[model samples]
Target: MLIGCSPSYDTSQAQQVEASNKQTLAQAESSLPHKAVVYQVFTRLYGNTNTTNKPWGTIDENGVGKFSDFTDIALKDIKSLGVTHVWYTGVPHHAVINDYTQIGISNDDPDVVKGRAGSPYAVKDYYNVNPDLADNPANRLAEFESLIARTHQNGMKVLIDIVPNHVARNYQSLSAPEGVEDFGFSDDNTVEYAKNNDFYYVIGQDFSVPDAINGYQALGGEAHPLSDGQFKESPAKWTGNGSRLAKPDANDWYETVKINYGVKPDGSYDFPRLPAGFEHKSAAEHYQFWQQQDAKDIPNSWRKFEHIAQYWLAKGVDGFRYDMAEMVPVEFWSYLNSHIKHAKTDAFLLAEVYNPNLYRAYIQQGKMDYLYDKVDLYDTLKAIIHDKKSTAQIAVDQAKVADIEAHMLHFLENHDEQRINSPDFAGTPEAALPAMVVSTLISRSPTLVYFGQDVGEPARENGGFGQATRTSIFDYVGVPAHQRWMNNGKFDGGQSTEQEKALRDYYQRLLNLSHSAPALKGEYQELDTYQRKQNVVGYDNKVFAFSRFSEQQKMLVISNFDQHNGKQFSLTLPQSLLKAWQFNHTETQYMHDVLSQIQVVYPIETQADGTAKLEITLAPLQSMVMVL
Candidate 1:
């Protein structure tokens, strides 16, 4: 059983103080049981055959596209990056309506129908694969299966994106039972029946007319009459700006209908309701009906997801990348996990929950295995790389990172968010190296790699919203490029731009060291630095040195976090341990002697210890961990 701490403690602290008070804390109290790396893929832009043989392809407005030449080969390359899981963007069917013939994209412009497939988030159908991507069913499945098999063969797992929050506008019309008037209506009655009375539309009577600033619009108007069984006036409106009657509602997902969480007929607490449209029935009757529906439909959905997972798992899938998992409810995950655990208990489930505080609520529910710890990672990276904070501050950030790792996923970028390679983050390939290094170093959960991040794939043409962002990466298809280049290197092809290589090597070294050292693995203990002002950090168990210390194999790790090229400092060993010991740089494994008096060099020397008489400098943003 995976043990866990009380999900209530605050993790934002300067450092881990009161060590004696925390020693009795169990490893389960430190973090959750998941620790696997995840890689995110934007399937559309991952590869294209026609352009540079890169794994990305372009898409037009009407949703027509060619097979990305890079899918199969790119999958092979992604597996070699030492990641355990691969998260593909939504594979569900989607469609885009174009008002004109012109094709281009503009920032913050919603009406312009640039020739691009609308975002996959605007899901068209849940049951069918995107036609463009399903060119050769057998081949695609085989390729996907091969990917999964390879991942699992390498001891990994897989997860497919499932959009349960809302269905595509065409979905209800396409899949709803015949004569279902409840398909597209916005009224108190329909809303009550559809969402089980858990939610209410904010109307003019209850509140002032909502403005367009937040994308609010009136539903029933002179041009558009209210559908039957719906209120004549509603807050929902079609934001798509087309004659299509079934577009998602602007206020509450115009294309997708909100699900009703069954509430008491007396308008009290909420509960689950029947899936199929059934109203005017007693709560007991409704409960029984929903139970029957769940017994049949949920099993099928579960089997479908499981089969999708198996397809990749059979291909050697490393782990899972879950999307909008919080929307699915705990019951569904509990059922899915029971079976998935049988297949691979070690399989990582990296969920996407943007808010760190909300993550705690989910962890307490035990509904998920892990959540993306982006907030902490973001704070740490920004402070160190952007704000240029001190090592002590960075150490403080690392503690929070450790706390989040106890129960969430961590990464620099993923499919749902903008690419780190975007213009916002120094648009050049040079940005990737430091980004990768910082991401890999402080990642508490399994690290996540957005697709094409390794190869320096450019940001999607249009903020990654519609077709512009869905380009394919099949351009690099059938090419014999160095896999290392894909894993680590700048697009410029220069030796000075080898941040990827260094970071890649660093990751491998760290991961390998973690595998070999118990202290580095399993659970982490927040160490203490006697001099916070000096920006020096130390951990208990004499594990602070740059070497691994197994009873039979003692090692120490130390670092000079200064920002300059070559500076030196001295470290005092804890009085409890012997002074005469051998030390090795964690990355280089070079042996060095450490006497009672030790001197170390750093590139940027921001930390100075007046009491211990120690001063060290490190290259700008440079950090090192030594082993003794």
Candidate 2:
């Protein structure tokens, strides 16, 4: 309708326009799922109200203990923390000898060896529930059902552990039939015993048989000696010029064998060759037979473990915490997710992918609903407390919070890492409050709290596994009186130091706030930091001073990252948009005009340049939030 005119822009203006567009797109992509919380549990050490001296049952090297002795008072206590999901660690059957008992492992010493129970990663059997975990192995379904039901009733979900990588050493699956000589296929004309060609990825340089004439030295008969493959200076050498033998892709790994991915000549992988006693058959027939009977395919291998997962879901479990998820094929996880969702629409899937690269792949595939975002948590915590970074840097770091919230599983500590209260940070009790606050409040995804974290427990060396950081809280051999040191603050002269009390109270308040405030509940936006001081960091948005805001609830959150005394600074508050607001401090109601200017004071240092600096504070770091 108007006169035909060609619109044109200056070169600089066009470039600026394009840059703005790209920034907007990037921001949109980063701001995804806004709310979630995760809680971590060491199932073995959590509690065992029913069992005695066997909290983890056979898995406990020091014998079993009562679940009631756990540091957590009750499931209700966990619920009070406002976590959305709970991840249990190591819930699989493992090898008794290889994983739990070995040289330097003593049966009498609790610190060195408690019993022959094994690490859950050993994975003795996938289909059967560990008998030690339940009084009646056949009734495992009932026990698991009750646990899931209780967890849901407490307003939370449960996720068990799963390992799908390598199987246990000395597993029964690889054993040859009784009295059968030359059981596998023969190759290279070396057929005195079973042919090695039938073994998956087994080659001349991969393994070595025991030379009976050489005192079985090549066979590793001493139980602790190096394997024959390890002694070879060629392809199997573990170090020196032949260090390539230790490569993860190597065809052999101790007794744990590798699987062949390439198709066999007969277009099958199950049956590569028939035994000397069996009649020769077509490759297809061998494949069919192996598929039906091979241990790697008998519903327990990495490819077939989904059936066991289905069984657990039917038993009322809601989800799983996949162990060593990085080692398994992504295709398997995709398959598992499809099957699990079909069975339970609300099923949760949390993968223990510690690496950022692997986690990104899983997130892109959507195979995992959540993953442990350790790197982000670690970096953010350091930036906030340790580094005392500038407000602008914190703002940049906080910008990633939205991305983390979308797919990350936040946690303060887990069994795999050192305890948060360890001396590495601040051994004093004061450190607990600040750690808990950051873990629970600042995170975008679900937050996890390890067992024994509520009450301080020192990390100790694992008995059989050398230098393990995690330790059990339940002391069986000693009387409750002797263990009084662990539970000091419960009564008088207990271990609940003043710092511990402050931390607990602080945690309780923060959790209550998270539950009560919609602004703090979900979705965080990184606002511009106007004052980029060393100690004081400030951010504001239209509705809130910080990036955290809730439009529907009409709430805004402003946090002070200053470590020391009060700081005087100015912020360009969006007055036109924030009309008639109330400041959230001590739950008080104040007119917006009455609090246009405010000052925050902490027990840290301050510079005249309006920068906030924190003091050499102990544990329970200081932080404050203002809500409008």
Candidate 3:
């Protein structure tokens, strides 16, 4: 399971492997309950209304959002959407403009930052809250603490970003706790590699800023006191994107420096790999394993991050969404995540891991609570939405990950992805209905909804990034659709149009239903074959059907990806599911379409052998979650 050596397998082979993996997972019993619906809100942009939207606008021109913006009403509204957790992206102190040097904060060189507002992944201080998020700059941490308290009071837990892969090019932690040392403060700057050093420095090379003739510049060519295109690292450290060059290309993540987690330039691990088959152990067990047996020596970088995690956990933070977690060693994750679970057993540890081969290792050995299901289900669903792929492919994607399905965090959009309604994506917001349904209902996995995606925020703002298809994570700008829903900080949809309101209503209804039903728990049966049976008509590949059931409750989900036309189809329940569910077939059971609030008193038709066949019709771009 090396990086580029992923093994190739046919469908039958994959299924066989999956069946064995399922046995392994069933033995481990690693599946957590379906209880988390995460709402990912960009901490910097959620409440900003200044729509000047100038590319790389100054903080004053394009006003920054404060922690105060997530008022009780806003948190309650989000909770009402059935969100159990709010992932506040960029809550940590990251590199940015807007001088705080007067308050002993170092002035960030604009030439090295991504925009007037820097990338959230470019963490500057591990122990502090971002000053830009504070109404009164000095009380940033207190404001963030207040936001966390308010969020919990509204019955929602808090999730903040923990960027383990890298830090800003100029890494300094001014507000770090007393007796805490800065990241590179104690590093042997002249060494090419050191097990205890936090960052890897080139032996004799001087840091030189990349030439800006690539049409990228700080402030979009506007001037700042620190926009001199000069940073002072005598022996340049490795760039965050893993560029070892002294002068990293402009296309690379040159604004940040990569963290050295006991890894070497030769691609050799400096830490010990978990003994064979450690995949089935729980975080608590892993913690005990480390405590009982010091199998491998620990690194200082590991100790620093553990302290950082403990610091936030002490401050009432419930979970963390690790940035580019796969980039860091899964061994380090085992150490850090075990420590976290050792402290707070239920603390959620989410990671961004895309390699299919690495999923099991990260989940079992690393003990992560969740991993982004981007490369598998999300990609397939997006392709199906755009008519670039078939619905049949979804079954393959799902089957491939059947073992660890519950740990996969499902989402249609997030900060790094293209917006649903963007031209580069599906041009219609309505297309999201079926995608969201399939993503949320397909498994017992956690569901995530980006803040403005509920109202179809096509991120078309040109904020000096490569492409504007994604909301500008780099610059200072207001999200137009989100602002209308914000209603000038009213946290109400007062200015939203009829279409926007209806779209939002659909989200509110569907997301709330995600938790209200018992269908999300134990067993699931796909109904694709039933819908397209031998004698059925009016159903095409444009439609998908599935069922979710527990002993107490059952749900049959039907979604229409055919956005332009209605569909009339017949459903034929499989004898296998019928036996598995042990449905009471002694009488004709009336099925209630909970989504539409419609009921079929006597099923569409009942066959001689006690099997049920129901003929149903769906509106264009509609999804039905029916209870039987």
The list of candidate 2 runs beyond 4 A from truth reads 1-36, 48-61, 65-73, 97-117, 135-142, 170-200, 204-303, 355-360, 383-394, 398-404, 460-469, 472-498, 533-545, 554-620
For all candidates in order, the CA lDDT equals 0.40, 0.44, 0.83
Q: Kindly list the per-residue Cα lDDT of model 1 for residues 1-628, writing each as its tens digit.
A: 1112222334443124323223423343334433355666655544422223322223332123223433344445555556556676645444433222121211111221111344465555433344445445434444545545554555545655655334443332232234323223333533323332312333332211212334322211112222122322243322222211222233433433333323222444233322321211222333344445544335234343445455444444545555566554443444444345456655555566666546644443323557776666565554443435543454455565454454555565555454454555435444434444444433334566665555444444432222233222211121112223432222222322366555444444543343233333332222235433335443221112222233333333443322233334444433222222222222322322221113653221112321212233333333344333
Better of 1 and 3 by lDDT: 3
RMSD of 2: 13.2
Summarize candidate 2's per-residue lDDT along 504-586 as a digit string, tens digits: 55555665565455555444543344323212233211111343555533333334433343333334333322332222223
lDDT of 1 at 83: 58
Per residue, candidate 3 scores C-alpha lDDT tens digits across 477-558 of 8899999999987777998877888889888888888866677876778878655555568778888888888877877888
Give the winner by lDDT.
3
Q: Cα miss at 25, model 3 (Å)?
A: 7.4
* Predicted structure 2: lDDT: 0.44
The TM-score values for the models, in the order shown, are 0.59, 0.61, 0.94
Between candidates 2 and 3, the one scoring higher on TM-score is 3
